[model samples]
Target: MLISKTVKINQTDNRVESVSCGECKGNKNHKILVSAEMAQDEDSCFDYQVIQCLGCNRISFRHALYEYTQYQATSEKIYPDPKQRLPIEGINLLKPYIQSIYKETLKTINNNQVILFGTGIRTILEAITQEQKTPGIDLNEKINNLVKQGLVTQKDVGALHDLRRIGNEATHSITPSSPKEIKVAMDVIEHLLQRIYILPHNVKENLSSPLKNKPNTK
Candidate 1:
């Protein structure tokens, strides 16, 4: 039921709310630095505010929507959608282009760009295969070659194929992957990256000396 209500802009209302902080990469308490309200019509209004994160002192814009209906709850949105993911440890160990694509893919998922997310996931797989010099004419063959080359296991091949299919659907048919599918694909990709690049590098750097130490021979 739509009801008419007067919207009031309260500049002095000091309210704190939990909001996601891009800089902190998590939810934090934010204080309203400034606020204004605009009535779209008699039944709805928007609250615009400049909010500062209490933890990091980072500032961002927020838009909240309110409707005069019994069933509707307040809707709040943050500008530049709070970045919730951090770069994987040892991301720099990846090829520069792969690193760039990985970071952008994270942002794409966070922005809810479902089509781009699928494409990005597939692109990352392609770039990895290329960088590893996995020889194949197509993505399927390339993924299979990864197992033959010992870069990924046969079990991983199935997951990579899933990613390939998601990317194919998004690219050729413009089909958006569901959130659950995206999440699982992302987990698979990240694990693949760590297994292929990050973990090996870390082991070599941190454990090699101990493992390679040999008794002195005169």
Candidate 2:
């Protein structure tokens, strides 16, 4: 369980900063921070000193006995882990699926477009995920940075997002994705390829077959 606390930040104090609270009124200044507790271990850690807010007189307290725990319980539902590992499902298979998507995408575009559209998109996503593992990393900011760096275009990034979302949904759910879902995922890959590469139209016709439908004799 976790709780939030609102506090004022001293300008000299780097810990707390002014922020907007969506639950409260418009642009009201508030510093939001979390305190977490584990029920099984009977352990509690408070993040009170870590941050301060520039807004109201409100100071939030997070504890098992506090309302914050209730908020956590009500706002977010926690489900038990499926006790599953990758290669079986989830992000693990994305690389291969993406590879297949790349081949199709290449057919739609030019040979020179391959590098820009290939594993580059996958690498970008993986980098974001890795950054998110640490609290200091902001995946959104990094994506923005990538755009500023001209390493990837916003259009290409958006298509990558669509593909990642479909892959995630397929992995998390027990029900296998319908053919429709698979196609959508494949489309994301294709879009990325078309946006960056230049491929021959003749090659495109030959590569029209779906990777999932191809027969595997091996």
Candidate 3:
């Protein structure tokens, strides 16, 4: 939406940037009907703009603040993957604690809160390690313990460690995550969940038939 700022806003002050119109359900340019300045100081000015979407001709209100020092845009809720409303819906068979954490993570992902997405993925790791009953001093050690238990292969553990590092970076870094990066990570998480929980359950259910006894100790 118009949440990202550009220096050209001063030059283009007459035109309100096109946003994803709720009525249009798509990005469309908007025309400003009024720019009633509400307040101003030496550094910034606030305004309430009445704008209409060019695509659908739907009118909406905009709360804007113009800053002389730097460009500032208002916060917005973004759904980069709207089709993925519940990114972790298939992880239902996982342990409740881990599943809940994963659902929360997906919520953040759906909101396009990049940093929170990473943190949420990291939390899922924590939940998995705990569920596997892997004991260690820290997460790295716990992940290694999971490897020892054969729940996670060594190579997978290495990749999980890398994800852990990236998650840490996301938690601390001010930079936002790109769609491609998060998509790859999301796929990995889904695969891991499938292997660790869903596949095992499927195997158990399929193998529950009466065993064919042969060469018995008669």
Candidate 4:
């Protein structure tokens, strides 16, 4: 989600600022170019580009495009097996990009049990549907039940649909797609996965001492 807000820049009054890329910490740079309209004098609109980080390739924007952030609460829906992740196509690796994002998000949450907190339903459903080619009948019913249980929210469900649509298009296109399209799909999948899965269990164990644990943490 992109949100726009005004921030004071260089002592200049309020200027629009928004976070462009969440992972790489890059910002957006909004430059306005004037073009003559046929009926009107001039039209102005903010341009969009991810100001990538030199060291880490993170992206952010200078002008406020609404920032993209994960929802705190989520809905339940199991996803397919990891083997079902989007294809890398030209890349020799199998879903390495997606795996990296999973690890990165896990690190951010600083807990492993939390990994499955928001993802139990999605992971299970995807594993069943994608691997077994089963219909999504009971899966969606479970999702509704989960929503009633407060396992996930409507917004997360919508985001999941959006990500799945983009992923399906990139993977199942009849004609070969451009590298940029593949990259966007991969990035979107990674982002979606990161947002849904908080952190994996193994990560939490390895990051902390055995005695430092707390009850009912996740």
**Which model scores highest in lDDT?**
1
Clashing pairs in 2: 6-60, 7-53, 16-52, 29-55, 109-198, 109-199, 110-197, 110-198, 110-199, 113-197
What is the Cα-based TM-score of model 2? 0.25
In model 3, the Cα lDDT at residue 177 comes to 64
Q: In model 2, where do residues sit more than 4 Å from their true spots?
A: 1-146, 197-218
lDDT tens per residue, model 1, 85-196: 5567889999999999999999887788999999999999999999999999999999999989999888889999999999999999999999899889999999999999
Backbone clash pairs in model 1 (N, Cα, C under 3 Å; residues 3+ apart or in different chains), count: 0
Candidate 1 ranges with C-alpha deviation above 4 Å: 1-83, 210-218
Q: Pick out the ten consecutive residues of candidate 3 with the lowest summed lDDT.
A: 75-84
Candidate 3 lDDT tens digits, 41-118? 565656566677888787777666767665543432222321344554457698888778878877777778888888
Candidate 4: segments with Cα more than 4 A from true spot: 1-125, 128-135, 138-153, 167-184, 192-198, 206-208, 212-218
* Candidate 2 deviation (Cα RMSD): 21.6
Give the Cα lDDT of each candidate.
Answer: 0.86, 0.38, 0.70, 0.35
How many Å off is the CA of 200 in candidate 3?
A: 0.6
Judged by TM-score relative to the true structure, which candidate is superior, 2 or 3?
Answer: 3
TM-score winner between candidates 1 and 2: 1
